[model samples]
Target chain A: MAKREYSYYPGCSSQKGASSSNMMKSVATMCEELDVQLNEIPDWNCCSASIGYGSGGELPRLVMSARNIALSEEHNPDQDIVATCAACWLSTREAAERFEDDENMFKEANEALAEAGMKLTNKTPIRHMAEVLIEDIGYEEIGKGVKKPLEGVKIAGYVGCQTNRPFGIDGESYENPMYLDGLVDALGGDSIPTYEKKVQCCGGALAFSEPEKSQEMIKGIIEAAYDNDADMIATPCPLCQANVEIYQDQINAKYGTKFDMPVVYYSQLISVAYGRNANDAALNGQIIKARKLEEIAAK
Target chain B: MSTNTAMVEKYRNNFLKEVEANVEEGEWVKMCMQCGVCAGSCPLGNAWEHPPQEIFMMIRAGKREDVLTSDSMWMCTSCYNCIVRCPRELPITHIMHGLAHYAKRLGIQPKGNPTQWFSEVFWNNMMKKGRVNELKLGLSMYFKDGFVSGIKESLKNAKLGMNMQKTKRMAPMEFFGGHGVKNPGDLQKIIKKAQELEAARIEEHGK
Candidate 1:
């Protein structure tokens, strides 16, 4: 089979030693196994995130992403750009949308890009990894790759904000997306039927700025999963994983709540289920160790 | 634009008017109709000093001092929950960030908006390197206020940091050998050009 090639924009979060570096490795391995080729955008910069727009106006933020888009076109022409980071996905897609909606903005952004000796026609379709799995690679194919089906593990699919809203899966409900749940089911895990926190926000970058307030939000997301008897929490965004997983102990201490929730990425679960080792899934960063995932992988 | 002071202030509301005039995305706040979907859907709605709806009302009421000084402006996580749920399709997330930016520009940021401080540190790091080195960024954000506070905060997160290191999650070497892109000069040029263009655009409005 000729590998389906895509221009991959592994956001800053995937850099070495960053929180989701392991997720990057896992995505690479899973892609190889699934026969989907990821040609990374050469020397990609930060997406300027939501904060980018907040600090600078629409134009600078637009240029930041537009520069990347222009580079992707220059290097990987005709190939769709795929972002692994949720913030990267949102910012890039948001830029694309703005360019498409307004002709003046598109022309102005291009003029700004000309200063950098680049041009972007905004033709490339920016897609998240979750969307690729659902559309490009079918669930049945993913299920067949599962050497270790997560038979007994019950997962709460925490879609979070970035991946779910503004540009979520085409057919999925923004209020209550089920793509994660569907992926869980494909991996042979039981997904919680009414995970109320599935759509809840995990305070993303706020985990740093306002820890107390942000942890309260993280607490609700994890607690809801535990309350529903979920063994692990699966998410798409790196910030969501960092906020929800990294702060469990701190949150417990702060709020006097008994909680130990393991947060894993959707790709991590897929990587392990596809017969790759736990390390490939970057399972070590999981503060609340996923014993269930380990046991299944060991089998 | 009318130079009538009180009439313009009372009729248009200073806060909302400033937001509309200054913030590009903040123009959509006029679409908000006191509907509470943005507030109701937010995970930290109750925690906010002024939830989404109340913030809208406060702007319309011309509570400039209150709006800029409130913790509510700094508390938004940029989750887009409010944006996705707002029936009026008001871009609440952008407006919230815009308010924070406006407050920062006016030097009226509230006392303890650590997130706002964190965001500053993060943006500076990104601008310089075209990438974020977590370890360096973390230290700068926590310690940006002062070394004493940095030590206190680092001690608090020492265990988490240690565990992250052991797990190979935190990139330690990045602090010493930054992971900026190969062509840092090119990235810096792009950043500078964008910044210059943005400054020019703002000048067009500020005048």
Candidate 2:
């Protein structure tokens, strides 16, 4: 039996063939090594992400998360709901918080849920995968599994936007979240302490809509990592991973600079350090390959 | 009177009150003391015609049409920098979204706003299947401007797309109606009912 189990909510980006499916693969591999089992909530729909606020409105947005929560409660009763996606976790957690604080909103949400023959009792706790990794599976335990430590790999942990602000991981500063750095250290990699742009926004869903502005923002993040002499950037959010990694070509084209920064999930680092092969860690999925991590994993 | 005009008359031209009643965390807008912290904190502060601080003041000053029609609110990426640094504990991010949402509902949001267009496309894509078909969403965004520009965008991204396909990160098969929920119809009914309930609530507020 696994030491801990969670009802997982893999957001749209983590779906097979989606943008950050590599993130899903690495998280699964990491979880397996850590003895954590993540069971997907059956028939779970989209959490509407943050962009949904424009079209979803207040009640509909709440109801979207409510439906997912209701489903998670029914299928995986008594287990806490966990999401790897920062936006999904934030939306669902915010909904849970709203259901607790506002009676009328809760009643309205239940009414909407009634339309689908589901009801939200708001019994289960919503959590990010990082919280489980840090709080539940502590650094010492995780360190124990590191058969091939990421030696000499200087990582700048980029806790961008959603995961670092408003409702960040417990006991972590919004401006400078140290949990990612700690994870890097646990994997025997050098964590750059002066990574100033860690919490900066990667333009979120607006990256595609407004590429220039978003790329300018992405430039600042990549430059900060380079300034610190980092090997790669690790992040907790899939959108952050996608935005920071996939746009280097455009950024280089527009700005007349060479930037080939490897932005990856922290879970990938963990899996690689745990002696998992490159395929197991899904390193090939990277738009900007982390050659150093891949070399380490191959060994 | 048009609903927008009637809304103005109903609130007696008090945009802040109208916002508080209709917007999602709009009551918190009154809490802004014009410290300009939010304006300074915004990542895209220079890009906005009116940052959060100015937008808040506009609401207080009853610049209803200007506040509603301005494209500033749509620039928000919900990075939550303002919310975290806000001394008043105001939910500035939600309020910004609420303002955009309110403007869109009143049918007065700025035209040709890319964010607004993408938001609509995303919402519709997710609503149809209860899961977002990312391929369709990406194609829709590229083609939104026109056929010629869409071709340019597709060709530009062709290498990236091929790389993604090679890595198995993106499946071309997804273009033909990818994964969906067990009961997309039921999910649609839930959203429809929720929307109706939201409409009724807004109507109650209007009264």
Question: Whole-model lDDT for model 2 versus the true structure?
Answer: 0.91
The estimated TM-scores of all candidates read 0.93, 0.99
lDDT (Cα, tens digit) per residue for candidate 1, span A1-299: 64688999998878777788877887887887788999899988898776664455567777789888998999999999999898999999888988998786788787777766778899999999888899988788889888888888999999889998777898899887888888899999999858999878777787777688788878888888978999999888888888888887798789899888888888888888888777777777676798888776666
Candidate 1 is scored at a TM of: 0.93
* Predicted candidate 1 versus true structure: per-residue lDDT over B1-207, tens digit per residue: 322233234445466766686665778877789878887877778778889788888888888778878878677777888887787788788788877876665566775767777777777788777877778888886786789988999999988888788777886888886777677677667667766765565445544
User: Cα RMSDs of all predictions?
Assistant: 3.0, 1.0
**Model 1 CAPRI rating:** medium
Q: Write candidate 2's Cα lDDT for B1-207 as tens digits.
A: 556766877898688999999999888888898898999999988888999989999999999888899999999998999999988988999999999998888889887899998888899999999998888888898899899999999999887788788878889999988988988999999999999999888877776
Worst 10 contiguous positions by lDDT, candidate 1 chain A: A50-59
Q: Best candidate, TM-score-wise?
A: 2
lDDT of 2 by residue, A1-299 (tens): 99899999998889999998999999999999999999999999999998998888899988989999999999999999999999999999999998899999999999988987898899899999999989998888889999999999999999998887789999999988899999999999999877999888889998989999999999999999999999999999999998998888888989987999999899899999999999989998998899999999988
